[model samples]
Target: MTNKAVLYRMVMDDHLCPYGLKSKDLLEREGYEVEDHHLTRRDEVDAFKAEHGVETTPQTFIDGRRIGGYDDLRAYFDKRVQDEDDTSYQPVIAIFSVAALMALSISWAAIGDLLTLRAFEWFVAISMCFLAVQKLQDLESFSTMFLNYDLLARRWVPYGKVYPFGEAAAGILMLSGSLVWLSAPIALFIGTVGAVSVFKAVYVDKRELKCACVGGNSNVPLGFVSLTENLMMMAMGIWMPIRQFVL
Candidate 1:
């Protein structure tokens, strides 16, 4: 016997329900023949909701049993459901993984090697840019989180706001191998301050807190990953000047 499911979702002229699409896709993927229903008009949606006594759209019914929405369907299949407030390293892991892949691709294209010194440099530089972008997404939130442990930001509130911009500028300059004079100092200063701050917060003070490395809203812990970010910045800051002037 073939498995079958039914789904009711919003598909209006102005807006389509994303969860509805996801529900349909999931059912199809799970070998279920879906009877899809679109509630296009507001009144139709309201009427359906009233009839079903449901508070939301994109509801699913499997094997003649109500399976709720996307989350519920996932739960029914024993899949992990994401909670926004949950602490996770997923974001950081994704960023670093992508950055490493990009660095390798660039190195292969430019130097005909996948594992060159240039690739390593680019990996760190790209990672910095990615992290900076995260912080820049919501400066207010980033600054607020940053002030929690950053020594300089605590004393100078504006420093927290300015940090993402500085990190971005330094990363870009380092990646392009341009204006060593400016990039090195910016990286060095921020990296030093960051390393010290993270060390004090996580180690010296033994305070447990979220890392603002990825962003203010990040759930990444304030320890190894955060310290590594600062250390990488410091290494790049020092290496760039020496590589340009010395080697």
Candidate 2:
């Protein structure tokens, strides 16, 4: 009779207890009609699904293309996102990986010119350590987003499981090199690992995520400079072998 209006399968955070209610409260505040599954009767929901062919939940459809769930919904809040079913994504972390490497490279020469070689070594090593930790944080964000919750998070593959450990290993090595008089074998191995780590992460992984690596409130695509930076980092990793022998 009335076009049988409907919406389904959106966010399921158990009242946002794990992270905070801010996400839910903010969504609600935005005039989005949210339906928490825990609040509804199971039988009624099943029946509604059967009646309306409701195949997806926490699903936000602006003019019809399914935008997945909470995360997608948030993404949609940005006008640039055209519609749901849109999966072309880039993460800031990707860009950061590149930028970080470039900074290290340029700083390598500048720090050398300005300070003692030993001092510059410390700066590079410590900078990588911090960046590695930053990558780990991004990993955590990916973990939360990829978990089987109320909607799309379940559909897309989880990525951090493939990358964080390697990055962490790199950080540990670089930090070690920075901190003390380590063997060339160890220093070279770690540096190589860091470089290879970023490359594997960038090219091997599928581009399904929002790239939360940008390290702030902004969400932007990982640019070409970022890609070039990763390549350079990969080279640096290779250079570690030489550095270990020489420096």
Candidate 3:
């Protein structure tokens, strides 16, 4: 006997339900023949929800048993469900992974080598830009979280708000290998402050707090990863000037 599933999801003129598409795709992937039902109109959606006693669209059923929504379906399939407040390194991992790939690609294209000093430099610079972008997404939230652990931000509240922009500026300048005078100091100053703050917060105070490295809303723990970010910046800051004037 063939396994079968039923899925009801909204498909409106203005908006298509993403979870509905995911549900259909998942069912097919799991070797289930899906009986897909589209509730295209608002009234139809409402009626379907009322009839099934469900609160949301993209409802799924397997073997004549209600399987709830997308998250429920994932749980049914023994997949990890994402929780907003859960402490996860996924965001930082993704940023660093992409940055590494980008750096390697650039090195290959430019210098005909995958692993070069240039590649490492680019990796750090790109990672900085990506991390800064995350914080820039919601500056207010970032500043609020930053002030919790950053000594400078605590004393000077506006420093938290300005940090993302400063990081981005330093990253861009470093990437282009320009304005060593400006970029180097910016990177060094922020990196030094950040390293000290993270060390004090996590080591000295032994406070358990979230890292604002990825973003304010990130669940990444405030510890080694955060310290590494600052250390990388400090390294880049010191290296760039020497590489330019000395080597």
Candidate 4:
């Protein structure tokens, strides 16, 4: 006799409980026979809820033992579920990865080569523009969060409000291959301030905080990604001027 698990889920005309499907799949994958129960109508769902005193659908039962919800079932099987509030590098990784690919694609299309110094400059510029877009989406929220650790922003709150605009302007100017005199200095000053702020907040003070690099709602840490963003700006700032004037 196979070990049997029961899954109660909604499969109504307009609704199908995703957790219920997941519960059934998990049980079958774990070598258990699944007895799937669908509450296909409102009254049936209501009765099921009343009988179990549960407020939601997709309740699971294993060998007559109840496992609460999707998260609970995962816990019962010693599996880990990502929490909503957990800090993750996923957002930053996704942004940089896509930006790098875009830079390569654009460089290849424009100049007929993927491997060139100009491509690197485009990569940095595109990255700045992308990050600036995030901040610009919610300037009020971004500035509020940015003031927490940015040295210049903390001293002069107006700077935090202007940071995203400056970033966008520099990036756009660099991308157009014009106005290096203006873009380079702006990038350098902001990048220098940002680098010092991140170093102080994360390394010197040993403080744990979220980075505003991607916006106010970001979960990226106030360390490596933040520092890298600043360093990229600084390198682009110094390189653009030299390339235009000397190289």
Structural similarity to truth (TM-score) of each candidate = 0.91, 0.36, 0.92, 0.85
Give the alpha carbon lDDT tens digit for every residue of 1-247 in model 4.
7988888999988988888888888888888888888899999989999999999988999878888888898898899888877788887888788888888999899999998788889889988999999999999989999998999998899998899999999999999889999999999999999999999999999999999999999887889889999999999999999999998
Clashes of each: 0, 9, 0, 0
Name the better of 1 and 2 by lDDT: 1
lDDT of 2: 0.43
On residues 143-166, what C-alpha lDDT tens digit does candidate 2 reach at each position?
Answer: 453232212223444433433444
Ranking of candidates on TM-score, top first: 3, 1, 4, 2
Native-vs-model 1 lDDT? 0.94
Residue clash pairs of candidate 1 = none
Candidate order (lDDT): 3, 1, 4, 2
C-alpha lDDT score of every prediction, in listed order: 0.94, 0.43, 0.94, 0.91
Deviation (Å) of 237 in candidate 4: 1.2
Total clashes in model 1, counting residue pairs 3 or more apart in sequence or in different chains = 0
Candidate 1 wrongly placed segments (more than 4 Å): none
Where's the lowest-lDDT run of ten residues in candidate 2? Answer: 1-10
Q: List, residue by residue over 1-247, the lDDT tens digit for candidate 1.
A: 7899999999999999999999999989989999999999999999999998999989999878898989999999899998877788888999999999999999999999999999999998899999999999999999999999999999999999999999999999988999999999999999999999999999999998998988888988889889999999999999999999999
Better of 3 and 4 by TM-score: 3
